[model samples]
Target: MRRLLALLVLLVLPLAGAHAQGDPPGVKGLFLLTDYPSQTVRAGEVTTIRVKVNNAGLVPEPLALSLQGVPAGWKADILGGGQPVAAVMAGVNQDVTVQIRVEVPKDAKPGSQNLVLNARGQIGQQASLPLTLTVGTETPAKLSLKSRLPSLRGTPRSAFEYTLTVGNDSGKDLTVALSAQGPANFQSTFTEGFGSNEISSIPIEAGQTKDIKLKVTPPRDVKAGDYPVLVKVAAEGATAEMRVTLQVSGQGKLALSTKDGRLSGEAEIGKASTYTLILNNDGTAPVEEVEMSGTVPANWKVEFNPKTIPSIAPNDKKEVQVAVTPADKAIAGDYVASFRANGRGEQASADFRITVTTSTLWGIVGVGVIAVALLVLLGAVARFGRR
Candidate 1:
């Protein structure tokens, strides 16, 4: 029984020491702390210090906050949820944060002052924290913008995205307005670095940085060359600028057809027929080193005059002579042949219906053979009639 009583005394002793709060380690019940207990402020400007009311192993209580030892002509307010509030309720093992917004006068001298934060709880609980605030000469507001990649290369049809970081080095929160200038007929907009919603301006806290994405699009008819882009971010009469480049590459489109736009022709059996094969470059760039080819029926023969072309200019056409011959035993029927032209990473093909006809010399021989057979049949009938 005596040993049991000793154990209970040990647990109660630790609880007794928890109420004695004076910056000691593991001091429980209630206390307030700011991440930065000391900070420097500029005259004629405003600054914000965040303070949290922490309740560790204590019952829920209401904490009333006030600042002590503030200099004269200085305006200070503790804000909760963007408004001035007198007190906040802190739950067990919870932290309640507030912002202390301090505004200094323009004529304030450069010096240091000690400010005390006092919190009074409803359950006879009281805690105090000390803060050091120094007023210094006013520094000019400044902004900076930097890009991860200042230049990019792609085709005119590609999506040019640039990643940029905007920094605010002032003493107060700022709303930064974004703008950009690019080549004529180009569209540019600002969005979240990893998002798609476009925005014109964003809010940034002092000494903080935000990443933004800039998307640019050029006209489909844009030529191949280097394009310059200028980006600007301004706030509170301070501006930051950055210049970037877009290297666009041109491309070409190919078209294959006959000049008359006819895809049908006539060829004789076992004889080669020559037809004009037209190739056109309908794009902004030239087509180079184009090789001619064709797909014909089985056992048939095909060839091209000047089998390869050197180049075809933009909006220009080149004609080649294609000699397509039908098979030796090819019957009188229609056949399909595909002609193609490949060059500069582009290709074009056209299908032509070729009608095959027997030679006139063979036709004449067939007529003579039929006539001889008819005459032989008539003579045999006359000989049998005389018998």
Candidate 2:
């Protein structure tokens, strides 16, 4: 009984260890599986399917991939990591995914075709997966583009921003290029809706949509009118276009100068000298709320009679009087004085040349003192001669 019990123990131990390690006893297998084993495809279009290679308690090995029973006029290839691959490796109890891309010819008949995807290991393990494809009518690649705000109104200095949605209806992923058509000197750029960095193209997945932003900036000298812009998108064998409008409004162009276009003026120390300034509106829009300001030498005074003008019509000019005074200790020489005017977000500045001279009161006092001294000297000489 002891011998029998010992033998039974030995037999059970080996079997238990084998079962715990992996598959029990003689169970070893490799499998190829896909959720979509049977599907329909369109002629002249390419499609890919995912396949999984599972190693169930089989020794880790590399298997070569091949397709069997493929009909003529059909193209099939296995892909791994976006590259064509002929073999794949799966460790014991591990699973790996591979892609099988199929391209059907346009001239093929509309009927059912059967194909087999196979993976064979060097140690004599083989796995086969059967697939069915029903070739039907043509399915064309397509794209769509739409803008949320089709038209915008702003000045030439403003950037017109537009939000757009791009959709991919094709059966595959694609990289699409973006472009725009508009008048000369009009700048345009594309970016993601949530991002500020610019992009010329973007990748989109099948049956999905992406939001993008378009910013258009026109030249400062652009005329006020309605301008149209054409936005285009192109992808692999498909294209789309959209039209948008930019309503550019007129803006005020303010300029500052003297009547004779001279930038020089004269001012006396401790006294204000008046200057005539010409403020011209050269744009199509009216200038409003024009404010005058000046920069002069240290401790000097300056002021405008009319601190601010109400408005100036297009192609019109306004005359303003500005008084500038030099500092008391300023030497007699040339000095530069700058004056600026601002109106409706427009600014202009001009420089004036000023020369200083001493006042007449100081000279008169000096002459009087000299005459008094001369009279005293003459009286002294007469007295000395009499003594």
lDDT of 2 by residue, 264-350 (tens): 876667888999999998876888999999998899888987889999887899998999888888887898888889887788888
Instruction: Give the range where candidate 2 is weakest over 10 consecutive residues by summed lDDT.
Output: 18-27
* lDDT for 162 (candidate 2): 91
Alpha-carbon RMSD, each predicted model: 7.8, 8.2
Native-referenced Cα lDDT, model 2: 0.88
Which candidate gets the maximum TM-score versus the true structure?
2
The regions of model 2 sitting more than 4 angstroms off are 1-38, 42-110, 114-132, 136-140, 172-175, 192-208, 235-238, 359-387
Give candidate 1's TM-score: 0.58
What's the lDDT of the predicted structure labeled candidate 1? 0.88
Model 1 misplacement above 4 A: 1-31, 35-49, 54-116, 121-125, 129-143, 167-179, 184-190, 197-209, 218-224, 233-239, 249-265, 276-321, 327-336, 351-387
Which lDDT values do the candidates have, in the order given?
Answer: 0.88, 0.88
